[model samples]
Target: MHQLTDCQLIQSPDDQAAYTSAINENPANAGTTGRTRRKRSLFNYSKLWANGRTLKIAFLDNPPAAHKQKIIAAASQWLPYINLKFVFVDDEGDIRIATGNNDNSSMLGTDALLIHPDHPTMNLGVPPDHADFDVIVIHEFGHALGAMHEHQHPQANIPWDKPKVYAFYQNREMNPLSKTQVDRNLFATFDTLSAVHTAYDRKSVMHHPVPNSLTLGDWEVPINRRISKKDKRLMRLLYPK
Candidate 1:
């Protein structure tokens, strides 16, 4: 299974065990300064409705009141920084959220519009304590808000140990991913995903915590629970006055 990342969501086929990890970070905070555009641009164009302005979201099967409230709160954290508003609806919406056992995923921005309405483009896992809960909710919402994983930034220079990285996910207890899957989800990077960006922010909510064991040298990021300073800065840049 791919690790827990801010955004690298390609819903796994696993229905029971959330074949998602908690260590994966996808930052296609890619190189936009040159030829690249922004990680979100790597995907197809937004379906317009999902491109700026008010964006509507829905919860499939309707989570419990408490869970729903928490989801709203976590997702709304970005509202103050970006010029985006999230409206929770009962009918067709720009983004739809579903629940899985331990997996959390989301389609980046308007990509959700292409999927069938009956299918969920976003999946939230079982809620944890405040820290994990907030991180998961906000990170997934970050994808909904057009932010990609920060680790995948083309300029992100993370020194990963191939063998150890492969072993880490394949041996996971939940939805374990194969070497190929791990490579695609974790070691993958984008080419032309540039936009208003900050220096590669290891603390960005889009990044996953890399354990020291997974890297060759002394490289690692702890499970980041808060949105980094640059994250807000980039959001403002993406939706400025």
Candidate 2:
């Protein structure tokens, strides 16, 4: 992965524009591709030493208590695999809460953070009331627990059709990327199959949405949802009991 300094150099306005254009032309190329591969350490569970101690987790209060329960349940299911002892705390001292902010969620020192009470997304007026809550909570918690995007795996060899991916992200107005973005994304070392990865899973809960047209080239899947076997193995390795 490009060092933070290198990343800064490419952050120049002209470079940014060029990078944006490149990404707009091919979203799949938003990560490392060739000759940028870096060696990574094997994921070793021994590295994460919870010491048989139950991890204390706390969620700042949010609306629709049911959604909180769902988030907790999802996280719980994945906890054992990581050999972690976890329990949710009820006091604010345990986890701070902000009504409409999630940016600081990771600062609590806890393993995960759920949605804020008044997030715009929750206010969208959907029937289920918590339509995207589960996905968001699970995905973010995956990060708090040290997961990274699967599409960005160092060993990945995505056949990104740059033109198609760039067009899709451009239409969506998501962060525009460049070859540097791609190289930084691909070259960074990972501990293991990130908890974020779904095994070649297009429907994996962690997979980000990419346009169908981008799947035509060397890209293998259209979407991803469930965590992959490789991901599970990596988790076990990272936090093994």
Candidate 3:
């Protein structure tokens, strides 16, 4: 049985502003109507950063030096796959991080631009000592880089036993999630145009740890600790380094 808390994908509160900001940052995000014949991986292109650009990451709450370094190091695992550069800073960054809370979340890609300059675009609530700390940080950074939850991939036909799934998240002692949150975050299927449709990868770090108890069959995905081969392929396609 896997017991790991999943990170939620955060969107800018304003939809109109988010769309405008995304296109402005990278016009390719405004995808074309024509079909893309080649199979790629999961990601909303509209949420991707400008290719080959440097993204400044600010630590908003001034976490301990050791804690901050560990977080930066975990996030940097994605650096080799994408065309972007990460520059950690003290203030005023393209992606602002806050460690004052226990809720892990991040604004997808360029949507971070919609947030107030003083606010955080991402939150890393997990402490450095946690067993899954590195994996958690890497998963959240995947969102910060515009990757969606792998379980919600269009090709991932998970046979969820809805009632059990709902109860599991709702009754959890810490950070209980509402039914609406469960539906959107877990059961929602993204658009084909927004993703590169292919066989679902159970090993992607962006996937949630689904216990078999919540599914109709024995289907379950264990916590993926590292970026998978397909994840590398997807990032390469999106950023093209």
* Best-performing candidate as measured by lDDT: 3
Deviation in angstroms for 50 in model 3? 0.6
lDDT of 2: 0.42
lDDT of 3 by residue, 52-148 (tens): 9999999999999999999999999999999999999999999999998767888888888988999999988888888888998899898888888
lDDT of 2 by residue, 1-241 (tens): 1111111111123434433433443332234344666642123111122334465555444536665566566556667567667676544322232324322123211212222323221111111244454444555445444555555555444666766655543454334456555444433434332423334434444445454466654345543335556656766765667
- Pairing residues by index, what is the TM-score of model 3? 0.91
Give lDDT per model, in order.
0.66, 0.42, 0.83
Off by over 4 Å in 2: 1-51, 92-132, 171-205, 215-223
- Model 1, which residues run further than 4 Å from truth? 1-8, 11-52, 128-131, 192-196
Measured with C-alpha atoms, the lDDT of residue 58 in candidate 1 is 84
Quick one: ranking by lDDT, best first?
3, 1, 2
**Window of ten residues with lowest summed lDDT in model 2:** 1-10
